[model samples]
Target: MTYTAPITEQTFVLETVAGIGEIQQLPAYESATPDLVQAILVEAGKLASGVFAPLNRKGDTEGAKWNDGAVTLPAGFADAYRQYVEGGWGSLGADPVYGGQGMPFVLASAVQEQLTSANMAFSLCMMLTQGAIEALGAHASEDQKQEYLTKLISGEWTGTMNLTEPQAGSDVGALRSRAEPHADGSYRITGQKIFITWGEHDVADNIIHLVLARLPDAPGGTKGISLFIVPKILPDGSRNDLRCVSIEHKLGIHASPTCTMSYGDEGNCIGYLVGAENAGMRAMFTMMNHARINVGMQGVSVAERAYQHALAFSKERVQVKRIIEHPDVRRMLMTMKSTTEAIRALGYLNAAAVDRAHGESDTEAKREWQALADLLTPVTKGYATDMGVEMSSLAVQVFGGMGFIEETGAAQHLRDSRIAPIYEGTNGIQALDLVNRKLPQGRWKPLFADIRETIRALPGDGDLGAIKPYLDDGLAALENATVWLVGNHGDGFDDAAAGATPYLRMFGIVAGGWLLAKQALAASERLAAGEGDPAFLKAKIVTARFFAEQIVPQGTALLGPITRGGALLFALDEAQFAA
Candidate 1:
């Protein structure tokens, strides 16, 4: 099935739920006019559907090949990447001082949704590079920025994050990589890094790796860790002391090479420190935070692709006058459609918060926006990814035996979606971060208040009135859960931790319901004014009502889990698990 970009739906979300008008009002983004945003979305849609989507099946089928430490992508992959570079797609929200287009990130996010929907694996390279650019922009030295940021922003070179090792996994502090000081003020990084995405690829001129290692005299654990810039090719055009030892044969995203890299094998891996010594985690979080949001978008992306694939199949497959005619099939389709839309709304809303956090000049306002962004980051990443997995599975079920087969391409979406929740920190980690770290900051107070205020302000008539009771119920459940988490967090940490996942799900469900309600209200006003397409607007209202009625109730259901504490979870011992 050919991928089609949902430009109209994306535009509606941006204009209605994401507050793009407020983003455009910011001084830095004054040039991001509605017309320009629309044009960019249109062009991005073409590239995503035309160039990228066609290669997705081929990439999955052929995968990437490795030979003697060299990696090669499937046919058309490199050419498609080259087209992506020539189109300046990577520079949309990049720094204008470094030859970027300097548009708002929300627009870039919409573009990313389309690209990811088209080809999840191929889009990863760009996503990682964008993260690297942000990290370097925040912490890299002037010389380092000049050497790296320009090329990265231009898409002339791609980037990778090397934190996981054979043993380190998610415990970054456990990494054994060593960095030795050199007479030239650079360092020699020596270690083996594993699970590095796009770490070794022939599609770009060079691969810039952001590696985390430790110094000999530094303290133990994470406090001693430092980040380094280790490139495949040095400035003088000589090969750096790094090589892709091997590429992983994985369950999904086969097109994206996950590499085992050996650095300083020849004892000459020249590297420059980012930020300060032993401050690697601080700098790396910059990249990780950026990546986490995009990973969430990946969840939305795969879900959309799976939904489209299943919807198309339902229309054509004739099992008693087309499966689309069946009520059960229609229910599944509606579930996929409403959930995907909810996730997309959450992702875009999060991106807008990022834009506001950065663009706001007032100190207090910036802090509030930043806090909101922090609170939503894990929810966006965790909830969306979990739902991505669920939606893909539903899509597979929709296709029955064909979904399990390779030719139908329905399974690919399922396979490709399985990684989002695992990477950029696991969904479990996101939950812990939410309840343990973010909730304690008390930022949720204003945010929760705003949700209540927004719900209260919404019109209580017709479709809006139908959704209000569900919204109120969901919000009440979310508030009670939040109180339970906070109260238990200090005296009963394990209790709070156990309930984190459920609490996060509740937050996402309620937040998503709120945004969709807002969208429905906007669509209603537009319909009354004859300002937009009636069919689309009415559909928006219906989707909102569906989500509120069907999905929002789950928030209330999760209240039990969110308040249940760790007694049952830890009651079973290690042997009991096996038993």
Candidate 2:
């Protein structure tokens, strides 16, 4: 099935659930008028469907090619990237001083969803580049910004983050890469980094690498680590002492090269430091936080694509009649539909929080919004990604035997989505961050109060009313789980950690239901006033009701496991597992 952008659904979620109107009221985003946002989305959808979607299958089949030390993308990828650059898609939400369009992040997020849904592998290059732009914009020196920001924002060059090594996967402090002070105030970097996405490619003029390495007199662990800018091509136009030793042959996203990068193989790799000495983690988090949210969007993106694919197939494929007419198939489709919408709502809502946190001028409001964003970040990343995997698997199940085959393309969605929960910090880590870190910050009180207010404000006598009871139950369960986890977090860290995963899942379901309930209210009001498309608005109400009835209860059901503690989890001795 050909990919089609769900513009109507996205716009509805943006305007109704995410409060784009309120976002635009901020000084930083006042220029993001509704007409301009619509124009941008329309053009982005065209680029996604017309240019990128066609390459999805070929990218999977052909994959990226690696020669002696160079990486080449699948056919037509370079051209697609060129179109992306030429159209200025990468400049949205970037700093205006650096030649960016300076659009709101929420609007840019909506555009990214369409792009990622069209071709996930192909969209990864842009994602990494944007992350680099953010890191440099926030941490790099004035000279560094002048040199790199414009080109990176304009898509003339691409960027990467190098954090992993053979022995130091999640334990970044264990890395052995070295950076020694040079004669000209620069540093000489020497290390072998792995799992570098789009680390080396022929699509752009140069690849800017943001690498983490330890200095000569630096202390042991992450504190001593410093961030460096190691470019494939130096300022003097000489080839830097770095090369792509090899690229990994992955399970999916085959078109995007995952390279094992070798720096200073000849012992002369040039490097420039970013930010203060021994403050790499702080700088890296700026990029990482940006990436974490985008990864959550990736979950929404792949799930939406999978749903569209499955829904299209169900309508076309017939056994006795159209598979969509079958009760079982219809259930699967509704599960996919309602779940996708819920996550999309959560993801977009999180994006709005980011915008408010950055753009809000009021000190107290900004702090609150930042706290809310931090709280939602982990839940959005963890729950949406786990659901991304489940939804894609269900999409494959809709095709039955044909899904297991390579030609049908359903299996690839599952394979591609599998990495989201692993990268950008694993979902387990996200869960722990949610319960162990965010919960202790005391931010959940205001957030919970807001959810309760929404529940109270929901009318009682229509479709919106149907959502109130289920949403209230889910919120109550979340509150109970939050109180239990917070109590255990101080003295029983293990117990809190043990239940963190389910706690995050429960939180996501409740948050998603709340956002959808808001959307349902908006849709109902529009229907009553005879505004907008009746059919679309009606579908919105139905999808929201379906989620409240079918999915919200799952949040309530998770409360037991969340409060069960860690005794059972640690009951078995490590060495006795085989027994």
RMSD of each: 1.0, 0.9
lDDT of 2 at 335: 88
lDDT of 2 at 244: 98
The local lDDT score (0 to 100) that residue 242 gets in candidate 2 is: 99
lDDT of 1 by residue, 1-579 (tens): 699999999999998878999999999899899999999999999999999999999999999899999999998999999999999999999999887888988899889989999999999999999999999999999989999999999999999999999889888899999999999899999999999999998899999999999999989889999999998999999999999999999999999999999999999998889999999999999999999999999989999999999999999988868999998888899999989999999999889999999898999999988898898899999999999999999999899898999999999999999999999999999999999999999999998887888689777788888999999999999989998999998989999999998899999999989888888888989999989899999998899899999999988799998888899997888999998
Candidate 1's clash total is: 0
Q: Output the worst ten-in-a-row residue range by lDDT, candidate 2.
A: 515-524
* Native-referenced Cα lDDT, model 2: 0.92
Question: After aligning candidate 2 to the native by TM-score, how far in Å is the CA of 106 from where it should be?
Answer: 0.9
- Which regions in candidate 1 have their CA more than 4 angstroms from the true location? none
TM-scores for every predicted model: 0.99, 0.99
